[model samples]
Target: MGRPTPDYRRYRCTIGGEVYTVHLNPRHGRRLLDLAIATGSELVWATTWEQYANDWIAPRIGLPSLPVIPLTSDPPSEHGEMFKTPHVAAYAGRRPFVWFDDQVWAEDEEYLRVRQGLADFLLIHVDPMRGLTSRHLGMAHEWLTLTGFSQGS
Candidate 1:
C-alpha cells in the first residue's frame, strides 16, 4: 500500500508553511511528544527510551512530559528486532495516534497492515533542512483531528 497521500509517500513536501530550523537528533523526542500530546494522540514506542522520553529524557532538554506507551521485545520466536516498528505499533493498540523515531518509514509494513484498524494516523518528521511544510502542518492537523492536542491545554 501507499501513503494517505501519494505525494507524501516519501518525504514529499506539501505542508505550505514556514520551514522551522530543527536539529535532527534523538534529542527532539520532547518536541515530538509535545506534538503528540497536542494532537491528543497516544505516544507509542518500540523501546523504553522512547516511552519515558518526555518524563526523563526530554526534561533534560527542557521539554514536557506526555502520555506514552512502550512495547517490549517480541518473543524470540518472532525474530526479536527492537527496531521492528510494525510490532511496536501493534503493541500501541488501535487508537488515533502518532508515533516517532527514525523508524517512521521503517514501519510502512506495519502501517499498511493496520491501516484499516486505525481511526487515524499522524506521521511526523522533524527535518533541520526542511523545517515544517503544509503536509507537515496537514499531518499535525490530521493528528489533532484524530487526537485532541492544543497549545498548552
Candidate 2:
C-alpha cells in the first residue's frame, strides 16, 4: 500500500486462481506524507484496493485515512484506456493532479492529456514487482518542482 518495511522485505504468492498472499509496510508512507506536505498535495487512495486500502494498508504505513476514488464498475473501454483511467480522470475533474499506479498505460496518458485540458497532470508507473522506490518519489518531487506545484512555489 505505502512504503516497504525497514529491509523492504515482502512476500507475494498466488496459490491458485482464487487464493493469494501479499505483504506491506510503513517507511514509504512517511516519505510520501512528507512529500505531500512539502508540495501541498492532497494524497488520495486511487487503488483498486479502495476502502480496503484505508482499512488494511494505511495504518501499517502510518498514513491517516484518505479519500478513495469510488470505483464500482469499469467504464467502457472503447478507447483502450484502463478501467481505472476514466474514473481517475473524472475524480480529478478540473484539478491538476499527479497519479502513481502500476497499471497506467500509454492510452491512459493520452486519455488524460485530452481529458485534463489545461490542467497539469503526471502519471508515474510503478513496477509491481519492485513496488514504490525512492527513485519514484524523487521523480514525483522533481515533477512538482518543475511544474511549480510545490508550496514554496
TM-score, one value per model: 0.45, 0.84
Tell me how candidate 2 scores on lDDT. 0.78
lDDT accuracy of residue 15 in candidate 2: 33
List model 1 lDDT by residue over 71-102, tens digit each.
Answer: 55645423222344555456556644554434
Worst 10 residues of 1 by lDDT: 6-15
Q: List per-candidate RMSD values in Å.
A: 11.4, 4.2
Model 2 per-residue lDDT at 106? 87
What are the lDDT figures for the candidates, one per model? 0.47, 0.78
Q: Model 1: residues >4 Å from true position, as ranges?
A: 1-38, 42-56, 65-68, 75-87, 106-116, 125-138, 146-153
Which 10 successive residues of model 2 have the least lDDT summed? 11-20
Q: Residue 122: error of model 2 in Å?
A: 0.9
